[model samples]
Target: MTAQYDNLATLESWNDSFKVSPHELPGERQMRARRVSGFLRARQAELPVVPAQEAASDAASGIADAGRKTAQIEREWVSAQWGLVPRWVKSEKDAKLRAPKLLVALNETVSTTQAFRDAWLAGQRCVIPMQAFYVEDLRGGKPVPTRIARVDGQPMGVAGVWECWKDPQSGAELLSYAILTINANNHALMRRYGHPGSDRRMPVILGEGTYDAWLSARQDKAREFMRAYPANWLLANPVENKKDKKPKGLFD
Candidate 1:
């Protein structure tokens, strides 16, 4: 997939579609690799859930944790860079140079990939809300920008992982995220996009019912929701202009 996409334009849509309050509106509607955009993630207070039996055992042994509580799994919208910056990065300059190449994490190796391993194992999964994602169709011999959205026209909640990095020099924290992609070589629709000979891949689109569940799932169980979105449910339309690759009629 390309390093660009479109996000929710209005506050009401962001609130209704993702069911969270964004502290600030996005300045840009179209997002590129390192742009700051809003994403939904479960509140950290309830993450890494403790099993009921484990909590009960601790309580009986007089070792109950004071901060432990039943899993409420609250979600919040956070403004983070679209490209993930590993917490281990040594410098801010290195982060800027590395963000673009780290835009998408392969689902097959996300758990083991060096750049994403810390965030993945820390249960930093998130949902990226977008109106649609852009790709280039080269079937016609030249690149033609294409807009890929759901057939129903509703917003899509894409699966991703988030991270927070601290500038070792300035001590400022940077929040960022990366979309998780799966092999689309066998997909009937997605296979038509991207480069001609390279392996096909697409973002992991989650179902409406699984948004909260995805954020609450344990690290090991998160992969269960990494299935590809149905090709028939998606609609792809050629953008009018390659340079100004905005969705037709909507932004005008």
Candidate 2:
């Protein structure tokens, strides 16, 4: 499964890229593990589990449909869609109308639209738990099929915002989310990636030390945690993409 975003690629099938791991990603384990560096094995102890809370309001969004899903890591990981459906949506068909974007830029949210304001001030915040995310290796400002992960092998927690909507007919509430991004033009690791004209953005990855503060911070206090992760701590590889698409769709 792959989640397309901002015409970019990634390590997990989530976001605007596809994830390929030595270990198949966990389906429902809250204590998820990234693919082991050299081998696929039963290994949960080697990595730390990201502490996440499924949005309190979305616990009942009846979006666990058989055909589509959204990804949100909570007490455990589950197969979910990579898009965020507005809490006001009433149909799957209507969801396509918003042309969901997978990312929400912090600077832009302050005045772009009411939805962003509501999500921000309402504390609709969420985090995408990732082992690694993909970035294009650039040469002449073009994207080369490549992936990136943590050199230290610890999972990265990406900041995000979530919303819940209901199916008009089924009355089932569904939860959808978007990852937060920040400009990375100054970061060596992230600056090295992106296609020509592609936004130089990287997910707002939080360390174990800051997870709770980020998750619980009020709107006015959230920005302090948006800084970029140091570039030297990551690893990049030229793994083949599991599947590629004819760049279509918007971010959600």
**How high is each candidate's TM-score?**
0.86, 0.61
Measured with C-alpha atoms, the lDDT of residue 17 in candidate 2 is 22
Q: Model 2 over residues 17-136: C-alpha lDDT tens digits? A: 212242344333221121111111111222232223443233234222111122232222333345556666667787765524433445456325555555667765655666666656
Tens-place lDDT per residue, model 1, 1-252, is 868899887788877887785776798789998998868988756345577776555444421131223256678888899899999999989999999999999999998999999999988889999999988999989888899999999999999999999999999999999999999999999999988789888999988877876877655456767788999999999988756667789878
- Model 2's lDDT to the true fold? 0.51
Please give the clash total of every predicted structure, in order: 0, 25
**Cα lDDT for residue 50, candidate 2:** 26
Model 1 clashing residue pairs (backbone): none
Residue 52 deviation, candidate 1, in Å? 11
Q: Pick the candidate with the highest lDDT.
A: 1
